[model samples]
Target chain A: MSVSTSQALDYLEQLPVQTHRKLYEQPSTVLAIFRCMLPHLAKSIVMGMLYMPTPISSPDLDAWFRPSAAKLKRSSLEILEKLHIVSQKQLDAVKHTAFTLSPGFAKSLRQALEGSGTHRSFGVPAPPTSARKVSVAELDDYARIQWESILFYMVGSTVGFHGGGGMARDIGKGTRSLLEAGDFVGKKFGGGVGITRTGFMFVLQDTNAQVWSLLIEYLKHVNQLGMSETDVLSFLFMLGSLELGQDYSTSTLSPTQLQMLIDLTAFGLVYRTSENASTFYPTRLATTLTSDSGALSATNNPHDHAPAPSGGATQKGFIIVETNYRIYAYTSSLLQIAVLSLFCKLTTRFPNLVSGKLTRASISRAVQTGISADQILSYLDSHAHPQMQKSVPFLPPTVTDQIRLWELEGERLECTDGYMLREFPSDKDYRDMVKYAEDLGVLVWKDDGERKFFVNRIEQMQEALKKQGQRRAR
Target chain B: MVKAVRGTLVKCDASIKAMLVDIDSKNNNDFIIEELDEEHMLVKETKVNALKNRLQQMMKDRLKDPTIDEDSGKE
Candidate 1:
């Protein structure tokens, strides 16, 4: 899944069953969730069960996959269960348990796929208007400008770049507070709101994911703003199904979604002439929200995971690095320059060029702000100049190696995502389990005194504990 | 009766752990769920970002930079 899909999926998976049940009422929302928010395996499982008359038997479902695919099947069902799309049942007539699709979700998805619904959930388009018209190209440009302005505002907030004042300063106060609420930018040490680590990662994500990220944050505030969360969500899903260049009628939207139009306009998801416009157009950003990685590769927006585009042309990447660690970027975009200055000690700037060096202090400073060495290296790799691409690794090996070494200088801690096991029944059990965990190569930290341990992987340890229980019973 | 708590295990130098403990104390002990050993901690997954920001701020104030900007070539 693309970052955008995962962002939406993560948000969807956390919603309570009641919310999901309400959200699944809209055929468009159901379709959008089915298309983008589910794992491929989950999608197949959902489709497989959609039309089945009876609850699928556990053994029958298990028979569908090979033993090698057990892990994937397990995770797919886990997602299905989490979304409340599928639930287990004890059949009165049968000897074993079975699972069936949630009736509402199955019905809505069927209606969405078969075009059998009069729900009017997809969206009602305004009749073509020659009086006030916007073309596709115009919409794309508006999105690029509006989206880049928000990005520039973020970049400008960090590092005190005050002179790039045209569009960046025009970001709405509502959007600014949303950024603040998301912890993208918090009050700095001096006075003004500064970019935090979450903000940096948000800036670094691809454009589609950035939109989802911001929108997910927007969803959190929908409740506080007295807007119905289901209405806001279904409207967003409806926007993804909208046809670009076709104007959508504001009369058909609920009051909450109508309010959303003004905000979505600010985020470049929709284009509107004024706040009171009768019609709004979904930009490229909005129309691509439901695509599965197609949006990521379709536009090749220069502000993506690589360097920001400047004076757009055949020059996709412009940053060139030397073995001596000097860096030269042929771009005039101030946003790109600001991003570079985060990690490089820039020395000179010409009309269309900038020169900088990756110094230890500069790299460490960047790392200090929570940008990882891998993020830096991949950014360099993606932005490697055309001539530099002829080489195997693209980036100068020595420079890349030294950059990693510099990052490790300030790092005295490492983290493992796992669990802390404690409350053992006896000291003997603790010693045995810790020994088993150590032998499994999953032991991260252990304390014999407290009869507790930390393990990076817990599945095997859980199995061992179960075996120990059985042994005690024996 | 073995019990396991789901969290992220953080292993660091004793000095860094001290700083982390200081950060946790200042935040009403919101970041860390438990301190398991001298250098091991189980931290809340969601509060990791807040902890990181605090640590970065702490480090920036403590560490002195040796490199000075010599950008005399700018026009």
Candidate 2:
């Protein structure tokens, strides 16, 4: 799974079971979750039990999966159980635990797969005779322009770059406040924009992940707006299933989704002829939301291979770096220039090209702003010009090493905000809980001799310790 | 009973840890919550950034910055 899918999946998994049930009522939402949210083995498990006449016994599941693959089986089943997709039931006749796919999930997923449902969860297409004809290229351009407004709002303000004199000023009030709430940006000392660490990471993530991150924030604040969370989520999933350049009807949508349509239009996910246009087209951004292609590889043309970026924008890798650390980029897009200006000290700019040099001062300045050396290097690597692609390593090794050294110069200590675990009742208890914490990926530091450890999280360790305490009392 | 203390864990070399301890002491003993081991210590959660800035300033005063061609290296 791409990092983007994991993010959305994490949010979905945390939703209450009741909300999951409501979300599963929609075929499009169910289909989107099944396609991108579930682990590979979980998907296979779901498929195996999808049409089964009876629930499969837990022992039978063990029989199906090889014993050597037990861990994978357990993990996959755990995820399925968490999502309420698969429920364990008492087989009254057999005296065993049997797993059945949740009725709502099974039915909706089946409908999605078979394309046989009256739920009309999928978007209703606009009539063929409709005058609005949007080409895929035009849709891509629109999506790019609309998405850039949000990005420029976050990056431009912090870096002191104004995205002057365009529709960039049409940044919606709803979107701006959402960014602030998400800590992607905050009002600075002078009442301008200050990019928080979370905001910096959000801006650096790929276009698709960026969209999901913002939409997830929107999802969080939906209840305050008196909108149904399921309605908003299902509409987003419905947008994912929609075809690019194809227009859909607004008449079929609920009021909350209609309001969402206005917000999503601001985000550039869907485009309409006008504010009141009855038909709207889902841009490349919307179509790629639930996609597994990783980044918003909006271009339907498969051969356009530029392994996309967690960098700012522009899919075509346009940067070229020399051994001396001087850089040249061929592009006229302000968004692209603004992103480049994050790590490089630009010396000259022409209509079609900009020249810059990576200096120690510039890299350190970016690091000070919470942009890491690795992010800068990956941005360079992924966006390396086509000519530079002929080389073994995309970026010049010397410059990359120097950039890392400069970033490392300022780093004296690493700090993690968490709890330190210590003073266990028994040696065995300390050892066992430390092992569990290690497995949970929360153990920050440990000393077996001292019988104390530091952990980045505490709830699970607390539960284990409590259980151990209970066992001792028993 | 296993006890968990809530704070920010800082990891550095022994020298840096000693410097942090000295810095914390000079700051009226406000930054550190507990010192766990040779290279690890727990400090006040909200004071991590302020402590970082202090460390950076001290390093500037104590260590010589070795960048020679930074200005002239750029085009």
Q: Chain B alone: TM-score in each candidate?
A: 0.80, 0.83
Please give the fraction of native interface contacts (Cα pairs under 8 Å between A and B) kept by each candidate.
0.94, 0.96
Off by over 4 Å in 1: A92-95, A165-167, A294-315, A416-418, A422-474, B5-8, B12-75
lDDT of each: 0.83, 0.84
By summed lDDT, the worst window of 10 consecutive residues in model 2 chain A runs over A303-312
Backbone clash pairs for candidate 1 read none
Worst 10 residues of 1 chain A by lDDT: A306-315
Q: Give the per-residue lDDT digits (tens) of candidate 2, residues A1-474.
A: 788888998898889999999999999999999998888999999999999988888888889888877767877887898899999897785457899999999999999999896998898998898374988767666676778778887777765667564524668789889999988898888778878878767776777788899999999999999999989999999999998778999999999999999999888898988999888999878888888764344444754433433223656678999999899998776667777888899989998789998888888888887888888887788788999999979887898899999998767789898988888888988988887887667888988988888888786678778878888997
Docking class of 1: medium
Which residues of candidate 2, in runs, are more than 4 Å off?
A: A52-78, A86-101, A130-132, A158-169, A189-191, A194-196, A294-312, B27-29, B68-75
lDDT of 1 by residue, A4-73 (tens): 7888888988899999899999999999989988889999999999999989999899998998777678
Report how closely model 2 matches the true complex, as a DockQ value.
Answer: 0.80
